[model samples]
Target: MTAVPLSDDIALRIGLAARILPEIGVARLLRVLDSALGLPPTADTLERLRLRDLRQGADGALADLEPERLKDALAILRGEVGDTQPPPLPEPYVEGELPGSIRVACASDSGEQLDGHFGAARRFLVYQVSTAEIRLIEVREIDDGRAEDDRNSYRAGLIADCQLLYVASIGGPAAAKVVKVDVHPIRLGAGGEIREHLRALQDVLAGHAPPWLAKVMRQGVAPAGGAA
Candidate 1:
C-alpha cells in the first residue's frame, strides 16, 4: 500500500498516541486510522473519531486495550493533551568537568520521569552523571517533522553525545540505530523518577565501573572549563 503523507502536527499527534499504546506499532496504528477515518487521516477526522470507530478498524490490535487506554490515545491524537513541562535544568557543565561521569539521556513524556519509548518520546532529558553528583544539563525535543523513514535515526542523532540512554521501551531496529551511534540503550520496563535512576547509576559508578561503563568514562573528553 502507498503511504499517506501527514502534516507535521498530525504526525506528532500520532507519535504521542503511539507512546500511550506501545502494544500497537505506529505503522499498524496508522493502518487502523486509515481504515477507520478513510485514507490520509487528519487531525480533524481523528478528533471526530469515537471508540467504536477504532474497535471496528483495529483488526484486533486494540481489542485487548482498556477503555481508559483508548480514551487517552484518542485524546492525544486530538491534541487535547500536552507534553509535560520539564523541571528546571541544573547549571550547565563543561564536557570534562564531571570526571569519570557518563552522559545519559532519559526518554520522558512526563517531566522528570523516565516514562517514554525511544521512538515516541516527546523529549530527551540529558544528564551529566558522576559518582559525586547528577546534573540535568539539557532537554532535547524530538523533531517529529522528520520523514518517517529516518525518524528513528534523527532521534538517535539528537542524543549522539550521550553515552547512555534510558527508555521505557524501544524496538529492536531503534535500539540498533542507538547502538550504531555508540550510545548504550537501557530499558527501564517500569519507568520511575529520573533522579532515582541517576542515583542508581551513581552507585554503579562509585562501586565498580563495569568494563562497558569504564570504556564510556574513558571516551569522555575533559572539560575546557566555563559553562557549556
Candidate 2:
C-alpha cells in the first residue's frame, strides 16, 4: 500500500498541536489526527514517528497538508488547551531599598511554564522574589522512593524555605500538608511561561500590591516603609 506523504508544514503544525494537548504522546496525537480527518486507523503513517524528532520526518507523507486542515483538527481536539498559568503573587518594589524578599517556588516541566502539579512535579524552580529583584536560587528535583503521603511531605520539605509555591494544581490533601508547613500554594494554568510570569511578578511589585502581596511586602521589609 502506498503511504500518504508527510510535509514539513504539517509536521510543524502538528507538533504545535501536540504540545498544546495534554496527556497525549506523539503516537496518540497522530491517531487522534487521523481519526479527526476520517482517515483509517493505520499506524503505518507514523509508526516510527517521534515528536521530538519530527523536523527530520516531515518530508515523507504529511506534505501538502492544508493549513485549514490543521486548524480543523485542532478545533475538534478531544479537549481544550487551557490558558497559561497565573503569574506570581503581587508585591511592591522600591529600588535600592531593603523592602523585603520572598522565596517563590514554581513547578514546571520544560522550564518554559509553571505547568506541573504539586504532587507530580519532577522539580521546582526556586526563586527569590523581592520588591525590585528576581533571582534564581535552584532547581530542586525529586527522587524519593517513599509512598504518596511521604513523598508529598518530602517534596514540601524540599521547598520549606520558599514562602510561596506555584503549581498547575494540587490535590486537597497535598494542599493541606503544604499549608501545615506554612508554605502557601497557588495554582496556575498549564501553559503560562515562567519567564513571563516573573515579569508579571515584577509588575506586581512595581504597583500597589493586593492584600496577600501587601503581606509579602510587609514581611520582606521594615515598618518604616522602604528601608533606607
Write down the RMSD of candidate 2 (Cα, Å).
12.9
lDDT of 2 at 140: 69
Checking candidate 1 for backbone clashes, the offending pairs are 96-222, 96-223
lDDT of 1 by residue, 1-228 (tens): 577798988888887788656668688889888888887888679889887777777575676765645665776776655565654565667667777778888888777888776756777888889899888887777766652546667788888878899988777777888899888999998888989999999999888889998899888832322111
For every candidate, C-alpha RMSD to the true structure in Å: 7.9, 12.9
**TM-score, every prediction:** 0.66, 0.51
What candidate 2 gets wrong by more than 4 Å, as runs, is 1-99, 146-149, 221-228
lDDT digits (tens) for residues 12-69 of candidate 2: 4455455333334456556554543434322343333333223222332322333322
Q: What value of lDDT does candidate 1 attain over all alpha carbons?
A: 0.77
* Backbone clash numbers for all candidates listed: 2, 13
**What is the C-alpha local distance difference test score of each model?**
0.77, 0.55
For model 2 the local lDDT of residue 81 reads: 23
